[model samples]
Target: MKTLHDLHRPLGATGLMVSPLGLGTVKLGRDQGVKYPSGFTIPDDRDAANLLALAQELGINLIDTAPAYGHSEERLGKLLRGQRDNWIIVSKVGEEFESGQSRHDFSPQHTRFSVERSLKLLGTDCIDLVLVHSDGQDVEILKDTGVYETLDALKREGAIRAFGLSGKTVEGGLLALDKGDCAMVTYNLNEQSERQVIDHAATLGKAILIKKALASGHVCLDSGVDPVQASFELVFGHPGVASAIIGTINPLHLSHNVRVAVSVIQSRR
Candidate 1:
């Protein structure tokens, strides 16, 4: 089977090389009412760091994080420091936070604070990619607020290398594609609802990274092997997908994922 390590793909014409599969930090620092992997009772800072380092060594260049996911940005920053030149960091803004919980808010001030906070937590002068976590279905985008303006300002200042949107729905993804430079979406073998959005995002010459490519572990069930390998191949096979962010606490599993992607690439070749 192929793993991500062998598949050297460009990051949506950004000129950065990334594997088809990336290590997602969502579970490492997030326990926000969402079901997490077993034995992940709390933030294992050491384990998280080790896995992150391994991912980089295995050729996974992109690490996706968000402020909404607990201390995800902080821990990822800690692990990638000094080695920052070795990885591509992507963070999200526009999410409202309160009392260990968060909600999406596109207020201009909120956007500014989110970018600053992400920078502080990430411990970096510039993040490779910044995604605006959608406040809702693309409805709020219709409003004339400083959200887009704020993002443009950050880009102009070089605080962020590029900007995109982490959409919540198919409509949100399409709206983001129409209005933003990059579009973070969820599309897997089992679901094709976002197919049009993915295609359009490709046509826009914007970067399109796939999330939930394994259907958030749903595709792993009923299959004896790790679904990530299969999932990575599936998404990478699509024309618009540039990369797929995936989660794994086990270093061996991570390596297996890379191997699976490599095999897939070799098969196609």
Candidate 2:
């Protein structure tokens, strides 16, 4: 039997390798104000560097962050500078950020700027993959030739090793996954509405990663569940799911998350 640590696997039908588990930096860096609307606000940055180092040592290599995740990309880049070769950094486009209140930036110039800034902030020459982050609105711009064609050109220049979508809705998620290259992340399992999409991932050859599966840890408490197993395994059980992106601020919490991820993958076999 593969131990919990060994459950991390390569992405399906692609050369991209990842630990089936990943470390999300939103809590450690971007989170601000109370987490009332969400849950469990982030801790201070005292241990952000330490925890990230620990995650890397533990072989959790898919490090995810976004410009929308205020300070997350900068913090991660600061800690991970010069080690770009050892990690796969995934950033997002379509999110606009200026003076801390920004919206979607789908124009080719803005999209290009987003990638350039992400690369600069992360202290890397190239990004392993880039996803267009959606907040469940105005996604018609995605089908536009300008944004995608720009991304395709970046792939050719090797500025991005791959490209894909990260949608907030099933209509948008499925469209992006089917029409473009690579994967999409969405709210899965908790929403029965997404079941067909989850099932469809297996047949599509498109890598499907899940987010909010634990309902940001809300459903777990409400439904009398621990959330770790239910959320991780529910989506991961589907052959389509490549991984579930979860975030935390504490080292012990991250350790627990790693255990859950390992358990989910191991149980499937």
lDDT of 2 by residue, 233-262 (tens): 677777777766766666776787777767
Clashing pairs in 2: 8-20
For 32-109, candidate 1 gives per-residue lDDT tens digits of 565544545544778777787778777788888888878788877777778888788888887754576667777778
lDDT of 1: 0.75
Angstrom error of the Cα, residue 13, model 1: value is: 3.7
Q: Report lDDT (Cα) of residue 174, candidate 1.
A: 74
Name the regions of candidate 2 deviating beyond 4 angstroms. Answer: 1-5, 33-46, 98-100, 221-225
Candidate number of the best lDDT: 1
Q: Assess candidate 2 and give its TM-score to the true structure.
A: 0.87
